[model samples]
Target chain A: MTTDTTTQGTALADEIREGAGAVVLDQVAKSFRGPTGVKMVVRDLSLSIRPGEFFSLLGPSGCGKTTTLRMIAGLEKVDSGRIFLGGVDATDLPAHARNVNTVFQNYALFPHLSVFDNVAYGLHRQHVPKAELRHRVMEALALVHMDGFAMHRPQQLSGGQQQRIALARSIVTRPSVLLLDEPLAALDLKLRESMQEELKRLQRELQLTFVFVTHDQAEAFAMSDRVAVMEGGNLVQVGSPEELYLRPATRFVTTFVGRANFIPASLVEGFSASSPDEVASRQLSESPDGEESVGAEPSIFVRPERLRLEIGDSSGQIKGPRVRGTVADKTFSGGQTIVRVKINDDVELSVTCDSASNEARDASIGGAAAVTWQPSDATLLDR
Target chain B: MLGRGLRGFVALSYVWFALWFIAPSAIMLIYAFGHTAGLTQKGLVNLNHLGLGNFWQALKYPSGPVLVASLENAVVATALCGVIAYPVAYFIARKLGPRTRAIVLLLVVLPFWTDYLLRMLGWRIFLSPLGLLYNGMQAVGWHVNYLSILDTRGAVMIGLVYNYLPLFILPLAVVLERIDPLLLQAADDLGAKPWTIFRTITFPISMAGVVAGTVLVFVPMLGDYVTPTLMGGARGLMIGSLVASEFTEGQNWSLGAAMAILLVVILVGIVAACWLLATGVRYVLARARERALARVLVTT
Candidate 1:
């Protein structure tokens, strides 16, 4: 919370003077000198990562997520902002002086050092006691399941093994925040899946704050306690994966997070006018903590899975907004079946039902179809 | 796995090598195994008495001390060149743009355009008492009354380093340029200072270049004929001049050829010893790591 009055502002600031968060970015900005002109990579971004929290910065390529991670690790300097690591201002610190470490995208392990020496690099820099350094390095290696590779050179290891060593090397120092910059992007699907679970377990066991950078939404949503969605050098939304998926704050978030079925402005106005109080109450109940305004305007939005499809008179008994149309197409995808309903020439809606459900079995191409969704599942895309 | 055309080219090169290099070296080898007989054929060899006598004779008396002095010059010159070349190579490879790097490399090899003997003669003139360097220092008002390093081993060392420095820089720079910049960043991220990164990562990775450059300069210095003759005078005599004197004035072609063979054996022996030492050190390091890991494994 913030106050405009000087006295209250000072009081509020003093109370949390120790640290507001484990890692805090106060309006960070970065720009690169492009061939054409100065190109803004990240602009006016403010965020706070909680202690022991597994946080992720999720975005497409060139969306400033990796740049944000680099700035946090002090590998890249901020154009105009402040970064705090464990309550200390780390904005002016060089990379080596910062208490944070990163697992690079390519896992840039030292080619000359053995696995043990690479993992022990940070501890050696700190002049940690020789015995303690060895114990900790072995401990870190064991955490990554690479204990047997202590004497092997990085060149002799496989990609997966090298990835484990890079992870071990970064975490050996027990930094304030362990930053991972697309650390699993190069792995194959099977290795990436297992590494995802391994990373989740490591975070939980270590109880260390993790700032993971990734472009894959599924990967970020599956592992992070909180996720920040970035687009065009700005923070679009920051929330739990469930919140971002269910209560997307912007049009970009609505489309980027999941597949969406839209009820046009023409249809939305009719239902919104007839049931104004109902829409307001549904919005309030879904976000009871006063995030209703975050969805600024009532825009009829529904996720494909939430759109219930029925074959006949059973649709009339449904307890929500309903529409009748002809089934345009249908597809069976093992676990679920998707049916396309043509409401009019200009409007069509996709509805998903359980593959073995009676509704899916009953729906036929060119036949009459009914679509309805629960009021609570309705979302208003912010204008 | 060479292509058809490349295989042809390789075969052609081998033929050229055999004709130009192998034939001459083989003749010298035969001379090294034979003894000289009769005053009329003193400069020529007598093939009847084939033995290691010439090799032993090459190592005896005045020749032995000259061989040692030659080795000393090679060692000193190679070390100085390596030390001077590393930083220049590192700066060009790691810090400069490709365009700037090419320019600097051109400057490094600029002196090689001149003739080798002309360069040695140039140095001899430059280090003379009334040379350009002495006058330049005097013009700068240095508090010196005398300047004479012309006929000394120091002047010969300078010539050796100046002549071979480009050889060392080119190879070291090539290897340094090939190192991934990401490794340096990784080191910095892992809390290593700049110097620590260079010591632990950069330097060790460029060792191939260091060894190659050492052989490039040291091997040539062992048989150098011009620099010591021009600058080493009498006291700084080297094995190369001794061998030259034997062939020209002493008319002992057998002893001269044998000296060349002895140099070859010593060079090969030194290379083998170094290779063995490197292997032994690597083995020791691996064993020490195992023991350290075992101790930690027990404790934890």
Candidate 2:
């Protein structure tokens, strides 16, 4: 990672790589004194964001993802645990001193300063020469396509424009880690789509580590190199987007990321079988200690898109896992038909098919049908 | 129909009430400008013939010593109060959270509960030759001059500041309260240091408040009579006391009326200046905003 530091004064870019400027959080916790006294918000959280990596903390509101991001930025004090930025103890450093800048959900731009001055501020603090400061600010603004907006105050900018300015301001400083706290939440649909593309492009162009926080799974999947799904102030799963979707560690992760249909099955001889209630009870009692196992099943999770629809009377004849149901409802979506099927027990499961094939299958509302999927497609989850 | 008629009656009553409030002042304005020999009015609204004689005589009356001293005391006291109250108000408004700020503000205004005369008398007793402070100095083997404060210009200034200090702070706090903490944080995040943040953001935004508080403290202090009479003794005679003397002791009703008009004119000027200052500040801020928008338009 040691580059030509001979010309450039303490080359920040080269130093950022090789895990030299990586941020590591070790066992962080934050608690507030409430009416019930000392309730913890983020409990014993630990994670590492590598240099040049885009990581997302995906969670529902109050899941403490924002708290974790703030702690990394040194904006919030950690109750316990250590934060190391570039292998330096930054747990006690103020936000200004940390080698990180955050784009808040609200954009938090200085209404009094023009976009140029706002972006130039951190450079000015560093005492970068005026000419160089202007050049750098313009360059960063140019990256976000906000170069002409330098003199505009934040209030005058539209929501998407302001968000880009916020990104530009943080990126101009070239901090090792750039944190985005739900930066696109305020944008409308069209703006959010465009900004999403711009944000991904910006991250790649700069090669700066990005730790973005959002509850939108689609957004997390779109931008993150790795996603950490959280629930009740705990990290339920941390993995790549594909890994999370294909094999979710918990039922909560499966449900949070996308829709899932849980069907009761029994693990008989390494194959999950549709078991009756009596055998399920016996298995549940016998496998009490197998609670943490992924295959311990009273319920099996299956994605709607993975289910294969077949004509009626194939329930008992199918070689593998299958369920008999009647078409409860159907929706035409131009490219595909989404059919909601009600099983023998009146449990609903959504299945998707190509519109042409759906018409060929002759499935409609109230039509008896059989939905089949392989055992591998259904991941047994602790329901 | 009945409700509408009742509403009409209420509106009529308000107009009558407003006329009642305006009638006395209207009569006084007519009297002040009229040519009056003691109690006899020579003409109705004939100021051209009267021709500033009343104002000129009032200004020259009693050697003008009281007028000079009072204006001097007020100028000094108001300036001093502005300087002293600004930082205190800024601290309470910006530094403390809601609960602590409420308590601090209460403490600042608590002394106003007592009678104004009692407070002035208390200050007099505290500074008296035989008072506790004087006695304490004597006990410490120090000889302090009692004549300095018993009835002097300094004592009058201090009295004026004490009486009007709260007036300055309340408006100052109001303005400071409206300043967003995020504005300062934004400045800091951009690269401005703590002092720079205050200089560019906090100080300029608070200018309106400073002007407002100055007028609040100064305009009233100019017309104050009790503090000067009680503490200034002989040397502390101000414009207010001169006007008081002309009306009460000298028995020059016309002269007093003229001087009172002068006081009103002075206050109106101060108010007009404040309005202009406020308007100027707002204009500058609006121009800055427009420039910002124009720049954004050019850049975008």
Q: Top TM-score: which candidate number?
A: 1
B95-132: candidate 2 lDDT, tens digit per residue:
89889999989998999888888988999998776797
| Candidate 2 accuracy as TM-score | 0.82
lDDT of each: 0.83, 0.76
> How many residue-pair clashes does candidate 2 contain?
6
lDDT of 2 at A325: 70
Q: Of the candidates shown, which would achieve the greatest lDDT relative to the real structure?
A: 1
lDDT of 2: 0.76
Clashing pairs in model 2, backbone N/Cα/C closer than 3 A: A116-A150, A121-B190, A121-B191, A122-B190, A148-B299, B70-B238
Second chain alone, TM-score for each candidate: 0.93, 0.80
| Separate DockQ for every predicted complex | 0.69, 0.25
Instruction: Put down candidate 1 lDDT per residue, A1-383, tens digits, no spaces.
Output: 11222332233224333332399999999999987999999999999999878999998899999999999988899999999888889899989998788999999998888999899889999999988788778777777788888999999998889999999898777676789999999999999999999999777666678899998889999999999999989999999999999888888888888888766432223234211324333333442222333223445678989988879656366666676788999999999999998878866889989999998999889999888777677665443
Judge the docking of candidate 2 as incorrect, acceptable, medium or high: acceptable
User: In candidate 1 chain A, what residue range of length 10 has the lowest lDDT sum?
Assistant: A266-275
Q: Estimate the TM-score of every prediction.
A: 0.86, 0.82
Least accurate 10 contiguous residues by lDDT in model 2 chain A: A1-10
Name the candidate that leads on DockQ.
Answer: 1
